[model samples]
Target: MPELPEVEYTARQLRALIVGAAIQEAHVFWTRTIGYPDWHDFCAEIVGRRIEGVRRRGKFLLLDLSGDFFLSIHRRMSGNLLLLSPGWQIDTSLRETDNAAWQTRGPTFLPPTATDVAYSRETSHCRVCFDLADGRRLLYTDPRKFGRMELWPCFSEAEALHGLGPEPLEDAFTVEHFAEELAKRKTVIKQVLLDQSVVAGVGNIYADEALFYAHIHPLRRANSLNASEIDALREGIISVLALGIEHGGTSFSDYRDLAGKAGNNFDHVRVFQQDGKPCVRCGTLIERRVIAQRSTHFCPTCQQLIAE
Candidate 1:
């Protein structure tokens, strides 16, 4: 699954290319991609609306439209967004084109072959496409089909986003906030960090990395931490997340940047997938275990199980 950093990267890339572009046409190849408002309503409502801006909240991408409507996309796993022009020739041999075409063409238009703008699937799993008036199209490709795209009124409340905990990178998520959230949970520290309601945007990869950085065991109870331990954990979480974003996110599986480029953060990971490798700090062998039904990687010698 593309976590916060990957989603944030995708949003940033989309914001740069799609903002101010009007939707000339809209197509929903997979009806299931739009979770709400029905497929017909989604197409009817989003067509002809200009993209005002693009933003991200947690793992959701929001494309603000001209009116009180926004396009929301959740790339659950194996999902990506690609921007292409009329001349774009997708390698249908390598990738499956879920849907393709121009939404609106200006008087002076570029030929499909001469446009020199192409967003190829490069792989067989391309799934959703959103055509814009500026001759550019936003495509959503997901091999597993676990992703979703939805349209809603601008005034619509994000019920799904409301209960999520504070963004770890925001000023609102201070050490005090982290401590408070942790104090309220009696679950294992790893489990608490993984809880979207406890702190949004954190996943197993980052949880493991943060715990390793803080020298906290995955099984440690959340409420057992002292003020100092809480502080360490807070810093660790922020540092790891910032690094992940700076490095374009980790690409352990099918995750890639908005342009379908691979991320480089996996090379910088300290312990997430380094099972049996030597720990960079203490020279101890990194270990992997199952916690909360997720694979966890850490150094047993570095992240002692003792409650701090």
Candidate 2:
């Protein structure tokens, strides 16, 4: 899934490129992923609208359009948005072209050998595509079919986003509020961090990283956090999220920037996916376990659970 950092990177980059651009064409390759009025009506409502702005709330990409309407796109898991520049050649091997071009995966690296070229030319997994008047095409690609797109009249009218928590990167996510939300449940700290209603956009990767940074074990109950521990956790969340954006979002899998380039944040991760490695600070062997049915990595020596 493209979490806060990855989705944030895409949202921030596309805002400058797509804002003010008219949607020359709107096409959906998979109707199952369209969480809107209807496929036919959605095209009718969005084709000519000018994109007023682009912003991100949690993991959702909000595209503000003219006529007070918006298109909310959730990248979900394994989904990415790629912008194709004018004169850019899509893969020639693709034949299912329509209003949206059936969005083939734009070539990542130029194929070197004969075997690689044949495979690169037939890239699929593009679920939607929007052609801008400037001749640029914005393609939404998802291999796992987990992402979704919704067309709405406005934010106030969208019922799906009624329960999102505060953005951790925002100033409004203070330590006091963090403690209050923590008290709302007595679950383990890792699950609390993963809960969208407690704090938006802190997924499995960041949850482990943040817990490690705060020196709090993932299995520790939320209410067990001391005042100092809560403060450290708050700082850890912000620090990791901000640093993630700076590093261009972690791309351990299908995540890519506007240009289909992999992010460098994965290289800078402290405990995420660095299992069986030495902890950066304590030099203890990092470990991995399953929490909330998700793989978690941390420094067992640094992040110790308190006996409750």
Query: Best candidate per lDDT, number?
Result: 2
Best by TM-score: 2
Which window of ten consecutive residues has the lowest lDDT sum in model 1?
101-110
Residue pairs with backbone atoms closer than 3 Å in model 1 (clashes): 68-154, 69-154, 87-112, 88-118, 95-123
lDDT by residue (tens digit), candidate 2, 1-308 = 87899888988899878899999887677777787778888888899999999988888989999999988989887888877666544443434444334433422323445544443322357677787999877888788778889889885544857778899999879888999988777888899998888898989888888898899999898988889999999999999999999999998867878877789999989999999899999899999989878898988889887578
- Give the C-alpha miss distance for residue 192 in model 2, angstroms: 1.0
Which sections of candidate 1 miss by over 4 Å? 89-123
Model 1 Cα RMSD, Å?
5.3
Estimate candidate 2's RMSD in Å. 4.3
Per-candidate clashes, comma-separated: 5, 0
